[model samples]
Target: MSNIEIVDSNISTNSEKSCVFDSSINIDEISYNDFFSNYLIANKPCIIQSNATKNWPCKKDWIQNGAPNFTLLKQLFGDCTVPVADCNKRFYNSQDKDEMTINDYLNYWMDFRAQNYPTDSPLLYLKDWHCKKEHPKMSIYQVPKYFASDWLNEYYSGRTNLNDDYMFVYIGPKGSWTPFHADVFSSYSWSANIHGRKRWLIFPPGEENHLRDSFGKLNYDVLEDERIKNDNKSVKFYDIIQETGEIIFVPSGWHHQVWNLEDTISINHNWVNGCNINNMWLALKNELLSVMREIEDCKEMEDWSSHCQLMLKASHGMNYAQFYDFLSFIAEKRINSLVYKTPNLSFDTWIFGKNHNLFDLRQIKIILENFVEDAKDKSIYNLICKNDEVEMLLNKIELVFQSCK
Candidate 1:
């Protein structure tokens, strides 16, 4: 169990039993099995009430005074380096007046500090701030010793091991918001609010097509695009005003954007459990399928040049989708052994005559006979033989055999 003490200027302690207000929820009270099995592991986003920081001694203390003043924020993060745009514009206004865009401010702070701060200071340069898949920045002055305390360790016990997780602290003046995007790899996250309020809009995986262009690749600048805001009709957003001693759980593949209403201080923890690992595998499988389709398209040009040209003309030069479907049809008919095994000859070498003599009708007939026999045993030979292209090839082989005889 590790404990962290954050001093804030906006929040104040009222008495021994209360601090600032009783709006905070205790996250530790919720059963881990229920939360993980029902919500987190399901990749559903939810507000855990006061679940975060309940075990920490400093939770109430940190919330009482809000987050530390700008002086302290600067002292803790002044030397940290971050990315800047080509024009060097580091700040932007959010749609809501109450919140600040944290990424913009962090970029400015990082740019300024990197130019003037001493190299020996505890602060380090923030890498991958612009990368959607990369974790945010952390201050060496505030991590490790401060984070490894007993209270924090226990608070995160049910979640994951933080030492192996990617973590970052976000500090911003009022009105900071993160744009909408899903993480690169599947990542489960916990965010603790130390200062002000934050609003989040989240959508479940596969529930909505949050992506406008290609599904896997993402553009960070898209958040600023008006087209996205106007086109996003199915998204549901949540408002969480965490004063102090509060944390939020973010599930994997859930598209979310965060906004910091009022000067805010927060820390985010990212991790992956067993279920999330499976989600990552599924995402990778989809990427592999896309690559395989491309290979099949190249093969089609060599095997069916005239058909490929006719298909392209019919589709106005956009026949990849048709080609992909055709390849999938062929794959469905292929035997598992044939599909999984490496080809004896590369497609290029086979098409260009290097292996032409090796692929004579006799050899091809033998290979096809064995393949057809296996497919028949698997109940897929008819499906393969039914294909017009496959039937044409078979007819050509028959003609060659007749001539040879």
Candidate 2:
């Protein structure tokens, strides 16, 4: 393991603070090789120190006097229309969100923080603003080496159909927070605090059993739940207080809830790579199953699978065809880098050449093979397998993998 360390805090009479989590690991200046081998491959979470974002302009330009620089931010991105969520209200399993100009949100923030404003107004949180896509001029930070091979963003760049990217900016007041949930697609995510502090309650895989009720419903709030505080056994979760400039790597499938200790702004990305692609696929299957169960009565219909696929696309963001497209796109890139002698090898894959390329190629091939075999009834398998483009890419990948041996 990559230097495991336990981090229990001083306990008071409060039962909530009684038992600490099993371990908390922090690394500074971790090399790409060490990061991949120790945390990525091991599917473990860790906090990397502030070296990654020390030089980011946001660290200075976006902060002033231990708070977010409202004037500077307005001068930079005031006119942009962005999505803001109502943190006090939940709708459709997430916070209610709408679009408004950045200036309007700033006005709300300023009013909310000033004296006794209308306290009944919901806490508006600026969530999931596509920082890179909307404002290409802002080069705040580079994708860290460990997280560069982001298939999601790479696949959807400038495409009309899949225009959305995973890179997001989150800004909220002191009481604003995200509810308990795993990342979308069960993807591994890294969050960097640029302005203020955040308190994170993270539950590792399988530990969520304690938080789930008998009916399989999860508790909305961890700190407020008596069951969580009372359960001294069968569950141990990390209580992390992330400070400004620190990065937290949340591994695939980990459930976490976050609270802003101060008025906070952060950059976060959800990524899928070779290490956690399997988990992503598994999460899709779970989503599909849930969708099917919801409309199980319609199973007798002839187009039931098609219905499931449509719902999957709407609910999970990608149907089988899109999933295949993502895999094929990534596979073709790897194959080309291996065959065409290009310097680009898909994000952080520059250092390790043919061996890593071949390994990733073989992994993609296996995932494709498994998906095809498993989804024989689906239209995507037939559409993808019979299509000349996908077939040619698969053949090229196979040839590359074979020649490497």
Candidate 3:
């Protein structure tokens, strides 16, 4: 029903005048190829009109009278325990959160509503509740085609061994806010407001450096920092208001803080695809390197590099072994789609033509090669390539590329 112009995957958008957009681009129509080239691959952020989300089940089930229908949420999820954060206190990089049932959290919100949302009490905000994971049967929201090429969710979802996903449901009241931070692994994220409104201050890639203090530490709350007053010219930040039923795309490496302008319920996801797979790989490399630096003195110990990988996995939920497997998993899927065509993935790959599929394979092959090279650094060849599958998958992807050529 939507007219999606198939963009030539190799054609650069900068050369196409109609494909370029100003910061004020408001897309009332959802074009998969154009959205992929203009925003996703371009790494720019934009707000798609609410018409994009008009048919989502959340627009009907989650909203009531222009606000969240808390009573219905409790009835659906009261027994499930959720994480609640106190906005008044900041813990290290993120606010400390405690687990409570959905019912209790809703009661706290209702009590706040009864009190006219006074500032005196600590704001209890429910953040990052995996309601979709727990209630997969419930048709809450659909992953828009614009974000359907999500490797993070696809990988985690396919693994029965893993019990996590990037999909999250956020519910909070007015004044409840998130601290300044980038998405996990610097992945691109899109958030859709199911109900209520949100005020967001998003800083581009380098503006966060201007907000850092003399200690070289990034400020947790940019709003409370005094350097903000003196350093206006150096920082380029966008203060945008997200309305109910609208979706906002936050690109990779963009640090942002969000405040609820009213009681809000939203669906959010951090996703990785061919366009930003390199960013994820680099983020993992840097995170692992930081961990290795912390324990550099342990090099004298037996299997010191192995210990670093262990700590990396424990802290970041991923290490070189798993990261390799992630790439391989996606590589195999593209291989199957392009080579065998047995396991149907038409829902995601339908809009993506042969060139787009080849692009995915190319991205995965580069990362796999990097993984093998990086593993050889510490003579950890057994960590990846010696396993044989990485090499086989790389060659298989190359075969696909050659066939395309």
Candidate 4:
């Protein structure tokens, strides 16, 4: 565990406050429009005021007095099994993960508490729980208006092809830390701390390029790596103390590490929208190319391209087809909105009004052009040609995009 101490408001001085909260933006400092134009569009990270999640129900249901409501949590969700990561040990690139019931996790947490919070390594942190999937009717928190333009969840939740969403709940005790990494698919993510403080070290987008060592391997822990600090003096980051109720808007490609300064619970959502869809496509292309290189000896193997896609999906949790489906899904919705002169009824994701819909459509068009060129270069051009619906969708998207312009 890192040696950073939690900033106590009563005991902390102005210097300590500046060190921890230099990156914070008061919630009232910016309206939703300012948030969209400044943070989301600019692809930057910021700690919004706790007021963003101040009114959330989880503050009441999940937190009792000043501590986590462990009793109620175990009562309602003890049966739900979640993957817990051992922070002290690394299994190659990531920590060792095991599945356990929420009940058992809560018990382990309580036992850790009873010991008076020892300086222990290897804290067990429950990483990602799709509790919304388990309890669909519960209202833990409403999505903040600034982040309501969440295309990723909107697509995953309504998909008939799969039952999944990126909404997640994270719970962990003090000293539990997550290693540095970018978000899945390089998408934007927002994490709201319902209770307890968190220490976050977030590096900007291209900082990752400097993080890799001579062997082209990234360090598992940025804080502990001497070479990373010595050799890459230019790499900068934001050290933020996210107090309880604060929501952090993490933009695409910003690699970050987080530690629970106390027993903590947070709601997180990984989302993609027109703003960062290009990053998503580029990530897929780069990952696919890397996978191809890994299995280059199998170039003569049957369906080698298909095998590469399968491996990509297995490793990255998504393939080009699924990504294309995501594009097509949003494209259809935006196209329908424009063609029928109808506003997007899904209020949570529709931003900037109808003209913003046009911008999204145009953004998709730009990516679609790159998608085709990449397919042809990869020798999988037939993947696009074989799908009649994809071709027609492309045509319709182009027409709508032009007409709207």
What is the C-alpha local distance difference test score of each model? Answer: 0.41, 0.75, 0.80, 0.79
Cα error, residue 156 of model 4, in Å, equals 0.8
Off by over 4 Å in 1: 1-25, 54-67, 73-77, 82-165, 210-243, 290-405
Candidate 2 RMSD computed on C-alpha atoms after optimal superposition onto the true structure: 7.2
Top-down TM-score ranking: 3, 4, 2, 1
lDDT against true structure, model 1: 0.41
> Over the stretch 1-405, how does candidate 2's per-residue lDDT look in tens digits?
111211211111122222223233444455665566667667777777776688888887888887678999999999999999898788855788899998999988888888443557788889989977887776677666777656777777635476688889999887889988999888889999998889888887888777776889887777667755674655677778988888888888999999888888999999887767888887887787899899999988987878888999999998777887888877777677767876443333333355555656666776777687667654446544566555576777878866656
Q: Provide the lDDT at 64 for model 3.
A: 82
TM-score result, candidate 2: 0.87
Q: How well does candidate 2 score on lDDT at residue 169?
A: 93
**Candidate 3 weakest lDDT stretch, 10 residues:** 13-22
Per-residue lDDT tens digits for candidate 4, residues 1-405, read 111111221221112111122367887766665666567667777787887787778887888888888899989999989989988779987899999999999998998888876766458999888998778788778777777767888888779468888999999998888998999999999998998889887887677777787998777888776644464557777777998888888888988888899888999999988778888999999999999999999899999999999999999989988888889888888788778865564433333356557667777877888888888898887864576566677799879867865
Q: Candidate 4: TM-score? A: 0.89
> Which stretches in model 4 have alpha-carbon errors above 4 Å?
1-22, 119-122, 227-233, 341-352, 402-405
Worst 10 residues of 2 by lDDT: 4-13
- Model 1 TM-score on a 0 to 1 scale: 0.44
